[model samples]
Target chain A: MADFSLFSRRFDVKRVPGFASVALGVFVMLYMPVILLVVYSFNKGTNLAFWEGFSLRWYVQAYHNEAVQEAAFRSLYLALIAATLATTAATMAALATTRTKKFRGQMLIYTLINQPLMVPEIVTAVALLIFFAMIKVATGHTGMIYLIVAHTAFCIPFAYLPIRARLESMDLTLETAAADLYASPWMTFRRVTLPLMWPGIVAGLMLAFVVSLDDVVITEFVKSAGQETLPTFMLGQLRRVVTPEVNAISTVLMAVSVIFVAMFFVLTGRKN
Target chain B: MIEIRNITKVFGAGEHAVTALQEINVNIAENEFFTLLGPSGCGKTTLLRLIAGFEHPSTGSMLLAGEDISLLPPNKRPVNTVFQNYALFPHMTVAGNIAFGLEMLGRPKAEVAETVDRMLRLVRMEELKNRQTSEISGGQQQRVALARALAPQPKVLLLDEPLSALDLKLRKEMQIELKRLQSETGITFVFVTHDQEEALTMSDRIAVMNAGRIHQIGSPRQIYDHPENRFVANFIGDSNFLNAKLGNIKDDQAELEFAAGRKVTVPLHRADLSDGEVSVLIRPEHVSIAEPTGNSHELTGVIENIVYFGTDTHYHLKLASGEAFMARLQNNPSEAEKRAAGDKVAVLMDAKAIQILRD
Candidate 1:
């Protein structure tokens, strides 16, 4: 009884019974479907509700399917290019907003950068579709470039938020001291500002990569025919048939996102 | 040497404008340890910033070594500042921070390393050269800041209350250390501090400022001993201001009659005294408690309160005319001379020690 009491006191399990129940309910509501989908991805039978003997047939099918392979490659390539472009642009925006004194229209620029996160995703997708159609008409070029541009635009705000937060929290006295010590503005940024803000840059890049990797609506609207990313491909598969191959592909993508998020946390967590 | 001429700094414009500095003019000689001393918000820091080229004056020019540097930016100027909070680079090691300025100037790596080592030894942090700035103590970080600012050997070094963040003992230690460093390096140091004692102890000459204007500029003794006005007299040290009427104005001395009709002659430090109402200033240390000598120059007062400091004691006295004043005496008073509350004592003012000022 004493050991039980000590354990209860240490864990405080009895004090937050209502909180524990709500948390349990929320976890079940959020992750149970994902868990079920993952479990069905290993199912040997076609029925998603009832689990059959476990097998790796769907994984093998996902791996071997040429369309799946092509879509996966396209998504990976698009996410990589989009995340890089967004991270670079967001970094410049963060530095401009946080490092300098307030100028005219600074608040407007900040609001504009964050507009994509505020507006509905479908509205943004339609706007991008119209904008890219004009660009395509003018340039006569419509390939992965449209999808990359759309993804990059959507990912900018996601990248900007964390990078801006990091820049705001940074001690600006170091830069001033650098300037006082005969460093030009460019040298100070390269040596002091860049090194200190590296973690934020990496975290922003990973967040943008994860966000762009899972996007389906924007990719569907902006991408031309024969340019189906993995998410859009999965959406098409779900519309036509109910199969475990889509679940397998989703599980792989989810695993990749989880890995990137975990890496993001690790990179941003360490103190310099 | 830095020459400042009619510099004025204003923040904002029109109705919202605040005058941070007003027509400041001073010349700081080369290798001089000059201090800008004032209360907070008095624009001492603004003057220091103007000299450092961090701020440009609104109405005047600043010349450094006879070259007009009024429009030059801080990086282009031959000056560096030790910030109030030390502001050492959190990401760099002690040696790395000290070597930063030399490296910025594109010096040879071997010379940069040598200068870093020399600066580390100068601050007596040779063993902590490899330590990160955040890993060290406040005092250590302060030394690193000084070393980093001094590494490039700029013509002028600006210190913005660099010792204000340290503990009391460490502050005292650094006060002496800073004075030694200033003299040893022979660099023109323009230090800004609100601490009066620090200004007195560290600076060769002090510029006392108040309300965005420089009130007086003199040596420490001159500032303390012979302040020009009521503000300087009260700001630098403990002073007792007595209302008086000027009776006779002579070449070397003046006769001042107190409120109680008692008259005394005071040495004239300034030549602008007229024959009307005046203010007589005397330091608390100059007022001595003694028995009634039946002299008209002495003031009879009753002790109101006695504050016993370890080294000295302050006796708050109420004069016969109901005016209150303080007299500070060394603690080594004879037992017979020790007077408590309600004791009647004659306050003696040395003729030379009493200062006469205009209203």
Candidate 2:
């Protein structure tokens, strides 16, 4: 017997089984590659194979390689700078776009800002190469500056999406109340809006950092000399020869990336 | 402490132009609790925004403390608003929320802490200082909003239906608390509310607005006893509008001729009565079931329906002239209750209690 009333509906008791099967399928598909990577990272075999024996030799090798270590450090350095600059600019853009009434070119500016999100990464890479070549031809300052610029531009739309979402979710009344309480604009942003917006900024920073760190196409097009990020360095290595050391470095990169992502989730979880 | 002169807010323009507020002029003293009472879309909130410095007037100037603050940003003005949703910062604790404004002023640590403590105590929320804002209850959130707004020590506190979010019992409790807080703080409180009972019970002076204009402004008793126009009379409280004509005026009493070809003397609020069609307004409570007495006008009607509520009884009656009337009677069994469904009843009202209004 069914209790057909307005107060009662078809509840999750009947729907959970279907949802569970779909969720289980999704989890299996996503986790299989990750599981394989983790399992192979511990393998003692020279070739990546079914587990022969467990050993910490690859981890040791990854830590000991000077080239690998240098590449990793360079990637981190560029990512930190890129993430900071990109997230700052994105936060500003998000604040402007999300919190204001319509103005001339606002919709156009919004579309332009998010254009990088839709356009292929290779297209952006080519576009950056062309733009920097023009800048290089004009100013004759061709160096890592172009690479940083390209990387930051690519990371901005990503960071902007999350930060803008956070800003939009926040109540407009709190800032208005802050203003009413005699707080100056700068003070209100620093105290009320900033603390409230911290999680979004952090999440955006982490995401931008990871994107910049992992990007190979933009770095390949923009880098002139001695400006190879870790992903580009890894690409160069893979083109030359395959090594157990390469797998080890890949595992290390994955680990560090996972840690940063976990930290992002932890901080952002407070809002939920 | 506030004077608004011909303030208006026009939203958009051209094909989408909408006038949100008309020429609104109002004055509030230093410690009076003024309320803008109306239904939704009556421009009450828009008027509040104009006074709060959030929205600049499209025309005319607003003066606070005799200074034109019409062009000032909200941060530059000494006015705080408790929003309808309370709008407490979820990131901050109650104490942190209270201290944020003072911190923005670059106040010293000890002074800010002391002020925050004082405000928490003022709202009787000192015990919840350490709790996260979201962890606290809604009532506590509202108190935190008050404490935070008051920490800056603004000249006025604007509340936008601050109690509309609460349940019935809690709403009653908060209304009393808010009135008491207003008296204690001596800060000018400008409240906007749609609930007429809330406006009548809590306000020192109520301004009833409709269609972007002030319909009437008076104390609760004045608005209830004497509404200036038909809209104010209908909106402020319940009224049975009986079609009547003004024949002549003698002192406070005026002649009201009903459609049944009977003339009765009724009280007129204004000294000057323009000769034409007018409506005679009488509250449900004022129309009694007693028989005709001295200085009373009597009418015979058949009771169409009688609704017995727990606290009060309602009688729906139809007169001989085909006009309908309703009367709310307080439940009392000691006096012989004469009204029942389809029973013949005589509705009586004194001449002094009648109000003449527009057609």
Candidate 3:
């Protein structure tokens, strides 16, 4: 038989020429700076550019600093509260958007929920600064509530995407079956819908936590005096003196983010 | 028992409105295996959904055992449905899926456990009761779905094409299994399927529907032997429709004149069949190929194509009147060896077996 083929016998798309080199170059450019920062966090000398012998002196110094300890604790506490609230709101919003029939202004509701991710971080930070300024003047109080609310608002879309995707992929007939078997709407959600999408919920929570913990621009603009989150505290330390201690803190934050992102992938990749 | 009266369901708004079921009225008896059979997009599934309370009628009333249930929610209605995809909970084990309904209904723990065990045994899945639903095969999932829906012991069980996903052999096995389960439990089973053979084999009464309207509802023999209209006759089984002229009608017998100057006195089935150009339905199995016998009831045709099935052979013939026809002959090696393509044969049909179809 003749070689009846529709495909061209030219360069293979699977194994493109010089593609491996380009990909290697991209990865090196992306990770080289972060790898250097991690390496300097354990350097014996205080200089960041020149690495002496490897030592844990900077880690010990960062550990002993009371301000760093306080800021780290506050960062964790804020992330926990904000992520919990954001995940709850996002789950409800996802259900409302996906489970019901489409209506007028449904697209508008989606746009508003994802507004934070679309707007520039600096713009949101400036808007929050002005809004919180008015609230502070009226209440005459300065508390962590303002920062928590701002973080929760910004983290909702980060939590919503995975959960909505999970719900959309789910078999809707399962819920209908539950109802047919005499389960109330709430009971059906609790037994079938909730457990089926539990992985997505957990992934959303982890993503929101990581995003809130890594935020710096909004924290820089929103925090009052003496209310320094870990990111803002690191910024202050960098301006006064650049040391391996700051690299140590950055390495720790990066480790936390990497762990969370890895877990998010594992959870969302799981098949139902 | 279920009674559906004047049920009409319309989806969407004015210009885009699509009528799914129109003026559907059915009264199902207790413990009867009723089937809604049709082609896809024909209101069979929609009517099943309406009975299961997934989709409410746009205008109608439904009563379950003398109680009005039209406005009741699905959770409040004493009904259960086995979905087409078997909608088993992926996270739960087979036993857990079976026990969910009893648990939701707040049965005692011991009773729920007892019912779950009985259901597992009924479906013969006791060995894999602890296995997750996703770990099982498609046929096993179908059994689990049946067990789960039957565990609740609802007043009515609605099955929406539950055997469609299985292979041919598995589908056949599940069809018999479903019939056995229905008979064992004595629950009113309302099954929905587009497969005519499946409906005929399992259902005590089948409602043949098309274009959101039910053409006929009767027993399997009634539907196959005497369909009220052309749609019902064509949908239930293989039928050859032929044009004929109706002559004088007296009592229940009418004179039907076919092509080639052939005429027969067949029993009239419809009162509205007037003496004019009309259509007649003849089942393939009712017609037989024979040697040319000079009888008025015989129509001569030349065999154009011959198809051999394992049990029967289909003879596609071109009649002398220039019309195509088909006749099924059971494979009998003693006499079947004599027939071949292009052989002139007489297509013999009984007068009582000929059904005059209403347009």
Q: What is the C-alpha lDDT of each candidate?
A: 0.90, 0.84, 0.92
Error in Å for residue B243 of model 1? 1.0
lDDT string, candidate 1, A186-207, tens digits: 9999889998898899999999
Candidate achieving the largest DockQ? 3
iRMSD for each candidate structure, in the order shown? 1.2, 1.6, 0.7
Superposed by TM-score, candidate 2 places the C-alpha of residue B19 at a distance from the truth, in angstroms, of: 1.6
- Residues B279-319, model 2: lDDT tens digits: 77789889777543433245767789988887888889888
Compute the DockQ of candidate 3: 0.84
Chain B TM-score against the true chain B, each candidate:
0.96, 0.94, 0.95
Please list all clashing residue pairs in model 1, or write none if there are none. Answer: none
Output candidate 1 Cα RMSD.
3.3
Per-residue CA lDDT of candidate 3, range A29-139, in tens?
A: 999999999999999998999978989999899999999999999999999999999999999999999999898999999999999999999999999999999999999
- How high is the TM-score of chain A in each model? 0.91, 0.85, 0.95
After best superposition, candidate 2 residue A157: deviation in angstroms? 1.1
Expressed as tens digits, the lDDT of each residue in B291-324 for candidate 3 is: 9877655789899999999899899999888988
Q: Estimate each model's TM-score.
A: 0.94, 0.91, 0.95
Sort order, lDDT high to low: 3, 1, 2
